[model samples]
Structure formats: structure tokens, C-alpha cells
Target chain A: MGEFELIRRYFASAACAAGAEGVALGIGDDCALLAPAPGEQLAVSTDTLVAGVHFPEVCDPFLLGQRALAVSASDLAAMGATPLAFTLALTLPTADAAWLEGFARGLNRMAHNCGLALVGGDTTRGPLSMTVTVFGRVPAGQALTRAGAQVGDLLCVGGVVGEAGGALELVLGRQQVAAEIAEPLLARYWSPQPQLAFGQALRGKATAALDVSDGLLADCGHISRASGVALVIESERLPASAALETLLGAERALQQKLGAGDDYVLAFTLPPRHLAELQAQWPQMAVVGRAEAGEGVRVLDARGQDITPRQGGYLHFME
Target chain B: MGEFELIRRYFASAACAAGAEGVALGIGDDCALLAPAPGEQLAVSTDTLVAGVHFPEVCDPFLLGQRALAVSASDLAAMGATPLAFTLALTLPTADAAWLEGFARGLNRMAHNCGLALVGGDTTRGPLSMTVTVFGRVPAGQALTRAGAQVGDLLCVGGVVGEAGGALELVLGRQQVAAEIAEPLLARYWSPQPQLAFGQALRGKATAALDVSDGLLADCGHISRASGVALVIESERLPASAALETLLGAERALQQKLGAGDDYVLAFTLPPRHLAELQAQWPQMAVVGRAEAGEGVRVLDARGQDITPRQGGYLHFME
Candidate 1:
């Protein structure tokens, strides 16, 4: 089949493409039309995953599909935008029917979970890569950003970190463990659920916010640099999942929690006044750090001594 | 340099990222924020250009950059949407500073001409490819689409076609010509302008519209299928530039005019009543044919004989 036929068979007939709320027009057009509410602003982000670079060159297409959309959608969560639509630009070496079907199934499942409609996309022949561009809407002047953190704000995370990082060992066959430890970590790696609802709830509450893709210390540095304040992380308070601890032990888990990336958890700064209220609503949200009147990000040990790591986060083009 | 530093040096500090009208936030965030006018709907489209497939494996980075954005922005023109912002997902094999500098210069030039803000993007290490997702805002209910063509509506194209097709010979080193002929043809290949203003002018007048990217015959088939009508093209009336005819003789030029793609010119169906007024304003716009009660696209000769070629257009994965 041709490119158009492949897209029609796998994607256009999917459930998410069946006229979602904000999409005025979907596939089969020069452009997809989206009508956001009168006073809302659109949040847009684009992410590309290349074969052998972002994921294993030979891996499950279904999981890759889910991970691709989730990775892109997390940017919208960071902005506290309501999911609206997305466009996928897929480049593949060949048109394999089974692979496309599996990929589409996973993509549709994630689209349903995220409330994102598949509006439009382009499929071409080339080395395998997928670029997903997600769109979401947020109320005017209410979207969360990384530039609003104030001194004395408590830095928090939406959930446990480093599970995906720990899972990398299992993915590369470097570690073997019980199903209990492996399954959860694999799930975190393959199908990270963007903290969409929690991010939306952060509107008007969290001082500054972003999804943690580049490790805690490094991503916190983004908040610090953007807001012109220092972030002090209490390393002892970092949350580690039971599975991660079981697989990698305490010290390594701590290292992974601080240094490894791809967690897809929301890290934000909230005022102390609103902490109790937000914590009451989101019990899993953990306070791990605090913002101060300084510059840069610092990690503090139990003894209140500086313990920041030399390396920050994953740098894409670094050798 | 790291990926972030490379982007900062080459892209984030570029002129296009300096806060355009519709963009609330440009780079340095998880997602960029865009706010369209209150009564406008956002028009979005994504296009991917892969190295060795879309363009030559080795070519001028500046020209490649210009072509990539222009190819994507054409979708906005086809929707009759005013250019607003775009996010580029660029994957490169290495962080070559010279190539990146040239690419960024060309990208900025087109972004300025197209009135598109550089909202956000991701740069990574991989085989070179670029997926550009462009956003534009069209007045609500006025965006032209391919589903609105009516029987008896005149089929029109915004400008001449086939120059880019003729230029392919020069690009691939298959033909040699004078500088005058080569310059214009190469320019057409590298920098075909999107008919943004012309498409906007067609908003209320044109019944259906799209940019011709997949050859005239093939793209018209899309309109035919979507509008549930047959498009009859008078092959004798198909416009061919003098440069194209000079490069490749009249018969070959005619074939290119009918079969070549990548023109980026707006093709639309308009009521006959609106033609004179629209033509008065857009003198380059030409009447090529009319819509009829049937299916698929048909090309006819001056003698009223069916002369449609068996091969309609280029297919991505046909081999």
C-alpha cells in the first residue's frame, strides 16, 4: 500500500481521530483546524525520537509508540495545558504492516489516555524516527512556567523518580530481577503517564513547574536559572520507588534518582502556605527541596553540606 | 558544545525567536505558548524532510533549511491561515557549527518572510532529518478546506508549476544550462514561495483549496475524492514558466507541469462569479479547469480528448 493508504488503515480510522472536542478538522486536509476556548492560550511542543539514539534500534514497536507520545505530551503537562491535538511526523525505512499496526494501537491507547486527538501527520521513507508535536490549551495568564519560583518556595515532585533510569539496565540485559521489580520499571520506561491532572491542578498554585526529563538536580537548575533563584535539594528526602531500591540498592538508587533522566515526573516550586493544602490533595507529591535567594542549583547532604554531582543531566550531542 | 548550548548559540538567539506577535513564549521551556486572536482557529500541519530522500544527502545546509520551513509553511497557506509560529524538531548526525550556522541563517530568513516565530524545537544526534510543525490562525469558519468544492466551480492554481521539476535535473547533475536558466530554476527548487496572501484572499471566495506538493494530477485527485467531484484539467491551459520550457523542451515541460511536485503553490476551486475579482487582485492566478459530477481527476487535451497519464504522482513507499 502507499503512504496515504497506510496512514488511513492504521491511524485515521483510530478512535482518537473521530472528532475530538477541540479539533474542528482532523486528518485528510492540508491543515488540521483547532479551536481553543475564547480566552485560552495554546501550548505546543515538538520532540523527535531516532532509532538507536532515543530507543533501541530493535525494540517493540508498541512500546516505542507509547513512549514517543508520552514524552511529547509531558511538555504540555509541564505547561498545565489541557490536551487537545497532536501531529506525528514518522519516517521509516519501510512500510511493514505488522509494525505499523502495533505502533498505531499503542499510539491510539496513549492518545485516549491523554485525551489527545490525532489531527494530522506525514509519513515518509527514511531511517526510522518519529517526531510528535503536541498541542494543548491553557487559560490565559494561568499556564505554569519555570519562571515564577520565588524564594522560600518548597520544591516538590509529583511522584517517584529514576524508575525509568533504573529500567535502562533491564532494557539493555545488564540486569535480571523478579517480575515485581522488572515489570514496574519496564512500565515506567515504556508507558510513562504524564502527570496531566496534577499539572492542571497546579495552575494558580505552584509557583513554577516543569516535567522532570533531565534528572532532578539538572531540571531544578532550569527552574533556578529561569526564575533567578537558587534551589536547594535535600537529597535525603528524594523519593525512591520500592522496585528501584530492590533492583539497584540504596546508594545506586539515590544516584539514579539524582543523576539519571527520563522520569516524566512533575517538579515544581510551591509556596509553604499552599503546601499543606496541595499535599492534602496529592498525598504522593513529595517535598524534596526549597528555593532560596541565590543563583544555581545545589544539593545538600544530611549534614547541610554541599554534595552536588559534577555531571548534571543527559546532553544529547555530548560525546 | 552540548545540545542546549548549540541550540542557544545557533537558534534561540536568532532573530525569529525574539517574541513574534502570536507567540507568548519562544524557547527555553518545556513547551512554547501561543495565543491566537480571540475569534480565530489555529491551523496546524507537520512535514518531515529526510536526508537522501527528500533532498540530496549532501547539499547546501542553508538551502535545505529554507526549503524545510517553506515546505511546512505551505500547509498554512493552503488553509488560508495567517502565519503565526512553528516548532522544529531537527535531528542531525553531528553538531557541525558551520552547517548549523548556515542552516540557522536560512531558517531565520524564511521565518521572517513567513512571519513565523521560532517557538520551540529539539535537537538531537541521529541521521539528519527535520520535522517542522507550523501553526497559523484563520478567522473562525473561514479557513479553506478540500471538502467544500462544488460542481461547476472553476479549478485554479495560484502560480506557474514545473520549474522545480525542471530544476531537479540541475540539482542531480543530470543537465547543464546557462546561469540565467540555472539560477531561476535552482531558486524555484530551493525557495518556492508559499502563496500566503493569495491563499488568505481566497478564504471566502474559494470553495476548496490545498497546496500542490504531490504533483498537479495527484493533488487534484485529493480534492476530487474529498469534494466527491471530478476535476477536469484542460492540459493546454496548464501554466509552464519560460525557464522550464527552455531547460526541457515543450513536451517535457508539459509533462513536468502535469506530473512534477514540490511547487508549493495554492490550488483551489472557486465559483465562476468570484474569479474575475480574484483574478484582478491576483493576476498570476489562472483558471485551469472545472469540477464535475464524478470521482477522481481527469486531464483533457485541447481536442477534448482524455489525456491523463497513468502515473498520477510520486508515492513515498511505492517501490
Candidate 2:
């Protein structure tokens, strides 16, 4: 099939959310049209995934497609915005019908779950890569920012962390873990679920907010640096999954959970007095630590002992 | 330098016209924020450039940076929207400070010229490539599209064509052209000037419009197929440069000129009766052809003889 037909048949048919309030016109157009609500502003972000770099060359195409969109959505989640639409720029060596079919299916599944519509993009012949740019809307001044945290704010995180890092270790055969333990961890690494709803809930409450993409310690450090405060993460309180305990043991797993990346969970700060209200809305949150009047991050054990690890977090270029 | 510093020290300084007009915030944040005019709508387009595909591997870094952003902005021009802001995703094999400096300089020059600001994007270690997504604003229902052409509308082109293609030929050493002719052509190919003002002027006037990125015949074929009409080109009327004429004699130049790509010129359909008003506004426009009652494209020389070329235009995958 030609370029236009390939786009319409595989891409334009992706499952989108029911309503079209923000999206004025969707796929199959020269450009996408969007109109934010009267009182809302637009938030935009973009990311690119390259073959053999961002993911393994032999990895599942379907999951890669889903993860590609999810990573960009994670940025919107970091901003506390409601998703509206997205555009994709896809480059491939050839027009492989089967690959396109599987990729589109994965893209549609994730897009529908996030309440986003596929708008406009381009397909070209080149080395394999995909670039997704996502849009979201939020009330003016309501979007969370990493620079808003105060020294006295409580630091918190949503859901489990470090499962994606453990999954990568298993995938690379660096560890001798069982498939049953490895399978779910691998899935988490491949398809991270961005905490969109949780992020929106922090709009007016959280002093600072960002998605934990690089790792707990590193990402939280971003908030501290931007907000000009010190972050004290309680190492013993770091959330860990059962799979992580079974594979890496509780001690090393604790470190992995703290330093591993690709966990698209919202990490935010709130006033100590509003901790009850935060828990009322989100029961899954863990009070990881607190912000202090200083610079940089410090990790403390349950006994109040400083237990900072040697490395900060994963660096893609160095790895 | 690390990713964050590389961006702040180089890429974040580009000026965006929209940022001053209530973009609210941009770059250096989790997500870029923009407040649209009360009634205006947003138009978005994305394009990716891979190393050895969209550009040569050994070209000047500054030019590559300028061209990557320019190509994406060309999409905004096609939709008859005014450029607001843009995001950049840069993937590099390693951290090359000199390359980043040159690229950012080139990108900033173009962004300043177009009044667009760099917002938020991702930077990762991977195969070398750059993806730029541009945002523009247009009044509701005033955006130009490919489906608005009527059978009797006149086909017009904004400026010179085939210079870029001829320049590429010279660059690849497929032909030995003089420096005087080669430099101008190469400049046109590497540093295209997007017709932003012209496109904005045509918003309520032109029937349909698109940038000539994929050759005249193929790009016009998009309008013909979308508008459900045949597009006939008067070959003798095609605007050709003296460099193109000198490189390939009149006959061959006409063929290459009709089927060459990367010109970044605007092609649109206008009502014949509006010629006087259009000329008064956009005197640079040159009438070259007209839409017909049938499907497909037909080319005729000065003598009314068929001048249809063998292979009509460039195909991305075939390259």
C-alpha cells in the first residue's frame, strides 16, 4: 500500500476516546486542530524511541508501540494535565504490513486507555524510529510544577517503584531469575502506566510534582534542585514489589527499587497538615520522606541512619 | 556536559513569539504551557530527520539543525497557520559539545526568524536523529486544507522550484556545476525559507494549500485526490531558476523541475475572479496550471504537446 493508505488503514483506525471536545479534527488531515476549553491552557511534550537504543531490536513490536506513546504521556502526567490528543512521526526501513498492523494495534489500545486521539503525523522510509508528541489541557495556574515545593512539604510517591529496573536486569540475563518472577517485571519495564489521574488530583494541593522516570532518588532530586530545597528520602519506606523481593532479595531489591528507572509514578510534595487529605484521595501513596531547608538529596534508613548509595541513578548515554 | 546542562546552555535560549503573547511558560519545565487566544485554535505538525536519510552524515551541524526545524515549520505553512512554538527531540550517539553548540545556533537562528520558541522535548543517547514538532494558531474554520479546491480553480506556486533538487545533484557529484550556480541551489536546499507570511495571507483567500516538500506532481496529486479532481500543469509555465536551466538544458530542466522535491514552496488553488485581489496582496504568486474535471495529473508544453515525464515524483521509501 502507498503511504496515505497505510496511514488511514492502520493508524487512523486506532481506537480513540468517545468524545471529541478538545480535538476539532483528528487523523487523516494535513494538520491536527485543537481548541482548549475557555478557562484551560495547553501543555505539550515530545519524545523519540530509536531501535536498538531505546528498546531491544528483537522485542515485541506491539509493546514497543504502546510504550512509545506511554513515555510521552508520562510527561503530561508530570504536569498534572488531562490528555487530549497526539501526533506520531514514524520512520521504518520498509512498509511491512504485519509490523504496521501490530504496532497500530498496540498504539490504539494505549491511546484509548489514556483518553487520547490520534491526530496528525507522518510516515517515512528510513531507519526504524518513532516520535510521539502529546498534548493536554489544564486550568491556568493549576498545573503542578517541580519548582513549587517548600522546605516543609512532605515528599510522597505513588504505587510500586524499581520493578522496571529489575525487569531490565532479567531481560539482559544479568540475573538468574525465574520467568514467572521475570515476566511481570518485564511487562512493567515495557509498558509503564503513567499515573494520569493521580497527577491531576495534585493540581491545587501538591506543592511540587513530577513523574518518576529516571529513578526515585534522581527524579526527586530534580524537585529539590528546582525548588531550592533538600530532599530526605527514607530508604526503608521505599515501595517494593513481591517479585522484586523474590528475585533480588529484600536488601539489594531495596537499592534497585530506589535507583531503577522507567517507573511512571507520580511523585509530589504536600503540606504536612494536608497529608490526611492526600491519603483520603490516594490510599496507594507512600510518604517516602520530606523536604528540608538545604541542598541536594539524602537517604535515611528507618533507624534515621544516613544510607546514601554510591550511584545516583541510571544514565542512558553512559550505560 | 550532561543532558540538562547541554539543553540549558545551548537550546533553551531561542526566542518564541508566542512565549511573549501568553505562552505562560516554556522550555526548562516538565511540559510547556501556552494560553491560546480566546477564540483561536491550535494546529500542530511533526517531522523527524535521521542521519543518512533526511540529511547527509557529514554536512555542517548548524545547517542540519536549521534544516530540521525548517522542514517541520514548512508543515505549519502548508496549513496556513502562524507558527507559535516548537519542541525538539535530539538523539545522539555521544555528547558532542561542538556539534550541540553549532546545531543549537542554527536552530536558534531559524526560531528567531520565525518568531517561535523552543518548548519541552526529550534528549536521549541513541543513533543520531532530530524530531521537531511545531505548533501554530489559526482562527476557527480559517485554516487552509487540501480538500477545498474546485475544478475551475487556478493552480499557483509561490516561488522558484527545482533549485534544491539540482543542488542535491551537484552535492552528490552526479553533475559538475559551477560554484556560482551550485552555492545558491545548495543554500536553497539546506536553508529553506518557509513562506509563513504568504501562507497567513492566503488563509481566507486560497481554496487549498500545501508545501512542496514531496515534489510538485506528487504533492499536487494529494490536493487532486483529496478534492476529487484532476490537476493539469502547463509545463512551459513552471518557474525555473537560471541555475536549473544552466545545469540541465530547458527540456531536461523542465522534467526535473516538475518532479523534484524539498523546494519548500507553497502550492495553492485560487478562484480566477479573485486574481486581482490576490495580486494586490501576494504579488509573488505565479499562475502555472489549473484543476480539471477528471482524476490524475496531465502536463502540456508550450506547443500543447504532452510533456508527461516517466516517473512523476520522488517516493520516500524508494530512496
Q: Write the per-residue lDDT of candidate 1 for residues A190-268, one digit (tens) a residue.
A: 9999999999999999989999888887899889999999999998898858999999998888888987788799999
Alpha carbon lDDT at A38, candidate 1 = 89
Q: What is the interface RMSD of each candidate, in Å?
A: 1.2, 2.3
Q: List the residue pairs that clash in candidate 2.
A: B16-B116, B16-B117, B17-B115
- Quote the lDDT for B195 in model 1: 91
| Residue range B33-79, candidate 1, lDDT tens digits | 88888899999999999998989999999999899999989999999
lDDT of 1: 0.89
Per model, how much of the real contact set is kept? 0.87, 0.62
Q: Against the true structure, what is every candidate's RMSD?
A: 1.5, 2.1
Candidate lDDT values, in order:
0.89, 0.83
After aligning candidate 2 to the native by TM-score, how far in Å is the CA of B164 from where it should be?
A: 0.8
DockQ of 2: 0.61
What ranges in model 2 sit over 4 Å off?
A15-19, A316-319, B15-19
- The sequence of per-residue lDDT tens digits that candidate 2 reaches over residues A66-179 is 999998898898899999899888988888879988899888888888877888777887778889999999999898888999988989998788898888787666887777
Q: What's the CA RMSD of model 1 in angstroms?
A: 1.5
